[model samples]
Target: MWASSARIYAVALKEIKQLSRDRVTFAMIVMIPLVQLILFGYAINTDARHIPAGVVDYTQNQTSRALILAIEATQAVNFQHHYYSPQEATDAIIRGDIKAVLILPHDLERRIALRSNRLTQDSARLLNEPIGQWLVDGSDTLIAATVRSLRTMPLNDVTQSALPQTPVTFEVVQWFNPEQRSVVNIVPGLLAIILTMTMILFTSAAIVREREQGNMEFLINTPIRPFELMLGKITPYVFAGLIQVSIILLVGHLLFSVPIRGGLLSLFGAALLFIFASLTLGLVISTIAKTQLQAMQLTVFILLPSILLSGFMFPYQAMPEPAQWIAEGLPATHFIRMVRAIVLREADFLVLQQDALWLVAFTLLGILLASVRFKKKLS
Candidate 1:
């Protein structure tokens, strides 16, 4: 029994020595938990604050100024840009400059004053009147819901002072997702995440597995060029990616009732480019990793940022500018925006042209980098 215990200790010590030699594995063991804690603790905020908002104060009177100040004081909204017209506000929202727009009417102050006097006389007559309009970009369900809550707090305070009993009413227009369904927002982004996670992990393992098993040495002796070999390995995965996209879209629609409001052809075309980009990114990771474990560790490193910064769980507008810039470089970020625009907004090819171009650029750049890293002879 003592000898058996000694043997077990020897094997355990051998494993510790092996683990110490594997720097990538050791780093993963130490860093993953720390990274997760920092990311989840600091980056994620359920109570989203300082939402970028464009204000169109047509009145520009004391009343409108007071209302804006009240909204800013709530710390829920930061009115960054003041627009002259509602059209300008709409343009800003469409350009992704702001999440919501507050359009106070020309007669906003007069209406509020009139409603104040009329509240003493008769409350029923002024019940249907609207004080202003709050146009919200509802692509992100969390932001939209938070914006609604934010708008309520200040409006309630203003109305209570003006008409103690009558509540102030705004024409709350939730664009894209009027019902503000969480599934509608989540399911589309899930497609981007599923594709990213699967493609990166699968492809990252490909070359590394071949190298580990000595098959890469055999392939290195072949007549095939490195770029050609890389392409061959990536081609099969492209179809697999499309299969994934199809299955996810079908399941999402059937189970969640998520709508595909846009053109199917356009959606599929953009998805193809994104899949190619993701697969090539995996290949690039494979080139850097000498072992399957290293491939997986690197894949996780990439995926953490993809999930956190790609606007999957949180709104990109709420992130700091540096994080936003990092997100812009990720294929998942562009793909998520494309998926949301296509599925939720019914956007056309023209609407998604910029995102498509970015995917194309990423695909090309990834392929170029992977080919440069890939060697004709085993390294």
Candidate 2:
């Protein structure tokens, strides 16, 4: 019995050793997840506010000033920079500097005065009130509506005057992805999707690949423990994941100019936790799958739900209570939020502890399930 046990232990040891030498697997494990984190964090943003606006006020009259004051007071929009000339404001909009531009014609005050004068002359005044034109960036519909509804009432007394010489005022505000660069937000989200998709998919496939080749039968017949087998399979991935991370970060910073606001230590810590959890999930899936096709199919099923329900593409808070609860349970949901906070907000550990704990729990649970199933599969 003692000799047989020793042989079993030796087999497990060899498997662990063999895993250390797989360079392709190692690179996949390390480099892929890191790239995803950088890409996803840059791409996803829900809390879009403070749009850039441009103003071109030809009126400059007291009536137009009142309208401008109303816009400034509403707090819905902010004038980032103003152009004295209408041509400059239009050019800025075309160049993507400003999302929306406000144009006040020279006759705006005169029109308002004319309408007011007409209203006073007859109780039922049939005067044409010239509608002011507000040019908005068609890209952000929400911001456009906000800019259009700055004020409803006219600023000056229309009954007393026919209208002023300078009647119109221009105010423009930029909306969603206001920096006007699509890559800034999309790149970060790509990092997350790539990391989760590639890492989980390949890791799940590795075990099935070995089994199909009959290598798993020889290793299992030798008496290697389930935990050891699982660890051996995952160890190579951990190293690969780290390498992929470095390359992605380098590319995002150098090529894309995506900023990394948080401390390297904190970001890496969060990444390790997420990777461990994700890899374990793959292991669990592999244990349940009888063939490589089955494993890939299962991964696809899990991937779609995780991506959709995880608040990656949409806001979890906006969903109904049932959907919200489902989102809360997904590891991707928390990871997405964690990566974004780290990159954008530079959140401290205290702020991110909840997500960290969740990832740890997920990894532990997955490891336990995979180990039990792995033992059965081998037996």
Candidate 3:
């Protein structure tokens, strides 16, 4: 018993010393928990307020203005853009520019007055009518639920009483997800996450694998350009990423009943750009990390933030400005927005041009950086 205990203690001590020596792994051990705590505690907020929304006030009258002000006072919706038409507002929603839009009809005043009277006594016409309409992007289940719950918005100027049940302030029309199934949102988000995990993990270990197999020195002896080498390493993974995408989408559509409303060309185009970006990012990590273990640690670090800040788990509109800015930098954020736009809204690629361009730029920049960094390693 004493001998066995001594051997166990010695092995434990050796592992502790080794862990301490591996500064990257040791640092990751400390950083991962700290990052999770900070993100969950300070960043993630479920009771989301100051939601970005648009308005299409067709009436543009005193009553409409009052109603808008009242909604703003609730702090649930912040009217940022004023659309001339509901179509414009809907396009904005599909493009993910805003979560919801208030469309006040030309007869909004009459509707509000009728609703005010109906609060005292029930009438069939007033019961069926809505003062205004809320065109909501139901891609995010949480935000949609919050917007749906706003049945009792207090109209102070026209009517002092809150509208409850039958004649609500605004009748919500959920786009992209009329059913509001969580699966519609999850499948596309899972696409982004799965691609991110696989592409980055596979390429992150590329150079380390070369070193581990004693081929790195031989490659260095040759006159292979760094950029060429990077292309060679990531090109295969790009095809692999596409295959993974196809599998996930097929399974999601068939098993989960997630709809593929957009053109396959646009979908695959976005995937291609994102795949290159992720793989190049992995290559950059491969150049930085000294070992396969460190490469994996770096991938984990990127993966965590990508999942949390990528609008996959939380509503992007709900996040603070700083968090939003950080999220903008993550490739996953742009990809998730693009994928959701295409799949859920059947949006044209032109609608999501900015995010598409960002992904392209990300791939180009990541490749350049990886090539340069790898060249330095070669030298």
Error of 2 at 121 (Å): 26
For residues 1-379, write the lDDT of model 3, one tens digit per residue.
9999999999999999999988889899999999989888877777778888999988987787877887788788899999999888888888888999988899877666665565455444675666778889888899988888775565444456554433355688998899989999999998889999889989989877887777877887888898899999999998899999999999999998999999999999998889988998999899878789899899999999899988899988778888889899999999999998999889888888999999899989998998877752333
lDDT of 1 at 206: 90
TM per candidate comes to 0.87, 0.55, 0.92
Where does candidate 2 have its weakest 10-residue lDDT segment? 122-131
- Residue 134 in candidate 1, Cα distance off native in Å: 1.1
Task: Give lDDT tens digits, candidate 1, residues 1-379.
Answer: 9999999999999999999999888888888888788667766666667898999987887778887888788787899999999888876676566889998888886667665556454445665677888999887888888777754433445654643544566777899888778888888888888888899889989988888888977886779887898899988888999998899899998998888888888788878988999999999999888898899898898888889989998887667777778889999999888778777766666666788899898888888999998886666
Instruction: Kindly indicate the candidate among 1 and 3 with the higher TM-score.
Output: 3
Candidate with best TM-score: 3
Candidate lDDT (C-alpha), each: 0.82, 0.64, 0.85
Ordered list by TM-score, greatest first = 3, 1, 2
* Model 2 quality (TM-score): 0.55
Which residue runs of candidate 2 sit more than 4 Å off their true CA positions?
1-180, 376-379
Query: lDDT tens string, model 2, 173-201?
Result: 44333454545444555556666776788
Better by lDDT, candidate 2 or 1:
1
The true-structure Cα RMSD of candidate 1 reads: 3.1
Error of 1 at 354 (Å): 4.4
Better-scoring candidate (lDDT), 1 or 3:
3
Q: Candidate 1: minimum summed lDDT over ten consecutive residues — where?
A: 151-160
